[model samples]
Target: MKFSYLGDDAEEVSDVLTRCIGPVRVQKPLNTALSYRYEFIAAGRVAFSRATSQGSLSIGQKGEVPKLLVLLPLHGAARVRIGRDDSLISIPGKAAILDGNRLSELQIEEARSHLSFVIDQGEIFRHLSAALERPVHGSIDFTPELDLTTGAGEILFKLSQIMATCLGDNAEIQELPSTLSHLSEGIVNLLVDTVPHRFSAALTEGEWLPSPRHVKRAVDFMHANLSAPISMTDIAEAAGIGVRSLQEGFKRFKGASPISYLAQLRMEAAHRDLLNADQRLSVAEIARKWGFRHMGRFANDYRKSYGCPPSEARRRLPLSDA
Candidate 1:
């Protein structure tokens, strides 16, 4: 889930960049020595990367970019053009949102370093559809420019920083698909709610509330299949309703999406197992028994919910069990 590349050969750098990012041509300044470094980490549907180099470079898109990409410069400015949009310059406190499926070009100056986030476009649309309680058909036209110094943008920037820092420091977290999925889902939800996009107005003007019966049914389904790989569609079918209706029912009555509710139930189940399991069961085993795939994430979530790690919970078992 992590990759690091350091080299002076522009051709080699180009090949690596193409593989990590989309199809692109990286050109070095004529007769100038180049020092290029790239570090990347991907978790679930979100990916973060850092690019640092000591020479000016011109990179041109050769094919479609399949994910929504955000570029924030740290040292030098970056000029970016996506599709036919006007070129925008990104500095330390500003960022550019590049449309997926669009050809683009980037110009980076010397001593350049920047952080980039690549989000799955399909995931974005899925979240948007759930929020609107309707099927979303096409791509969202997001404002290409984002100001990182104020308001929602600042919050987003901080969140990205925290995610990058935590994931970078604790490599084991990367292996937890569930944790990474939740993290990516948070980012998608934030973007759909706050970022200026074509669907912004529709999202704000919605007023579709499902019945309490539907919500109850969905909850029952989630409880019955707590250990199964269930989807929104499955929950909806079990509730005798549509997927969007299920989402609305949970939002209106439970104040949480169905998926979030399911996760909460699973977390509580994991907590109970941690407390009740015999000494033969390790914390990791209890976690896996309840569908938790990674110890690091399971411990973190357990601490948040019970004010202690799973190990601590096990150690506090009753004298009879001990």
Candidate 2:
């Protein structure tokens, strides 16, 4: 999940950049001696990268890019060209969002230091489809520019900085697979909610609050799939309603979102398993059985819900139950 490369050879730098970033054709490779230092970390369909190079690197691609890219320059600047005529310069305190299904060129200046995030376009669309409770056929139209010093863009920048710092520090939480998965989706969700995209209006528009029958349907579906990796789209499909409607219904009826309701169910299920499960099954095993993947988070939630930890909950149960 981590990659680092440092070299002076142009071809090797190109190869390393291609491997770390994406498929890129380096221009003027034979004439320059470059010192390129790059590090990359990836989780699921999302990736973070840092690059510092002593010499300029020009890269261009002929076909569509596979992942949506966000570039944040820390020092120096990069000239970016999307499609044919749309071009911009990415410097410090600014971020550039590049679409996945577009031809692009990048001009990295000497002594440039920047951090970039890459997210798979397919995964983005899949999450979008789930939020919409329907299939999405086309790519999102995102505003190419972001002022990273203020507003939601600044929050996103800070989040990326924090995540990169955590990953770089080899933090204990870096090993959390479920956390990583959630982080990826959460980042996409934030971008969708805050960024100026084609679907922003549709996503923000209010939906009709469903009746009690629909709310009951969603609750029943969630209870039936407590341990399953079901998404909002699945719950909406089961309830015969849109995701927005289902969300409003859950809020009106259960005072929570569908996901939160499902989490509550899963937590109760975990508590029940802890109380009655065989002593041989550890708290972790019981948690996993009820779809809790991150043990730390599971334990924390368990304590909050039961006024005690899972182990204590299990120990307090009557001997006959055990």
Candidate 3:
């Protein structure tokens, strides 16, 4: 969708911005004539908009935001405050991306013109979760002040301009669903990959360094002591390393946690025993023998890894089918 609004009333501009962005209050200098030119272009969860105001204004909210907003000043300058601690000044080529859930304050001291990107927070999180291959909880916070002078920030700025220009009024891309979907995914993935956060660490590319000697020791210990109970700290200490080092090494070398790697070993051993067991042995017994404390969860993970629940696997004929 593409649209534009030109108005002189501050109240109407305030209402429009609130509806377009989020719940916000706008206060303009008294008796100053409001010259506003607002443009909007939207595709799916992504929207490109630019608003210019001749009247000095203060725009803010008392509560947390519901979506992510990337605000770039094409002209004019402003100071922004996030919650109560972080604050910054933004000008041309310097953008502020508000994806964090917090009260925000933006004071436009002089006549200002800016482009804004309104992205669905849920869509961003879903992309991040998919990239990490894990469930992402809590808010993914980025550096509030984004320096668009170089690197990823510059790319994001240019991409936004292209999206805004392409989807402007009279463009046919609004009718092209596949192209719009690709654009939306590109924008969201850009933010997810470029923005630093807790979840992004897992998605970061690292060099293929050889596994340190400790990793082999840890795996050997796990295999030799599969039936015995052990903790990550215990395994780390036995491998002659700290718990954190072992964790990072395992995540890098093994692509799994030490604890999770132990689970795989236990499950594999249990699978072999189940295949060779006599009729008197039960699936639950085999799982317990491998130190699997929770049969239900173990069954679920086993199903995911082996294509069947342990019980069903045990009941099947032992003859080779392949």
- Summarize candidate 3's per-residue lDDT along 114-173 as a digit string, tens digits: 888888665775685455432333467777767788988888888777776754667666
Candidate 3 Cα lDDT to native: 0.74
Give the distance in Å from residue 18's predicted Cα in candidate 2 to where it truly belongs.
Answer: 2.7
Order candidates by TM-score, high to low: 1, 2, 3
Model 3 lDDT-worst window of ten: 313-322
**lDDT at position 182, candidate 1:** 79
Decoy 3 TM-score against native: 0.62
Instruction: Give the whole-model CA lDDT for all candidates, comma-separated.
Output: 0.74, 0.74, 0.74
- Candidate 1 local lDDT, 1-322, one digit each (tens): 6778989988888897777666678998799888998878776667778888888888887765436888877788778877785788878888788875667888877688888888766567668656754334345778888888998778778767756663455566666778767777777787778889987876666433443677768877888999988898999999999988878777765557888778777886876677676779887777887788977987887665444566766655331121
For candidate 1, what is the total of clashing residue pairs?
0
Candidate 2 lands at a TM-score of 0.63
lDDT of 2 by residue, 1-322 (tens): 7657777776676686666556677765467767877777777778777878888778786445446888888899889999889999989998899985677888876778888888766567667545654333345878998899998888878878866764465665568878767777778887877889876765666422233777778777877888889999999999999999989877754446888778877886787688678889999899998899999998887765444567776765231111
Better of 1 and 3 by TM-score: 1
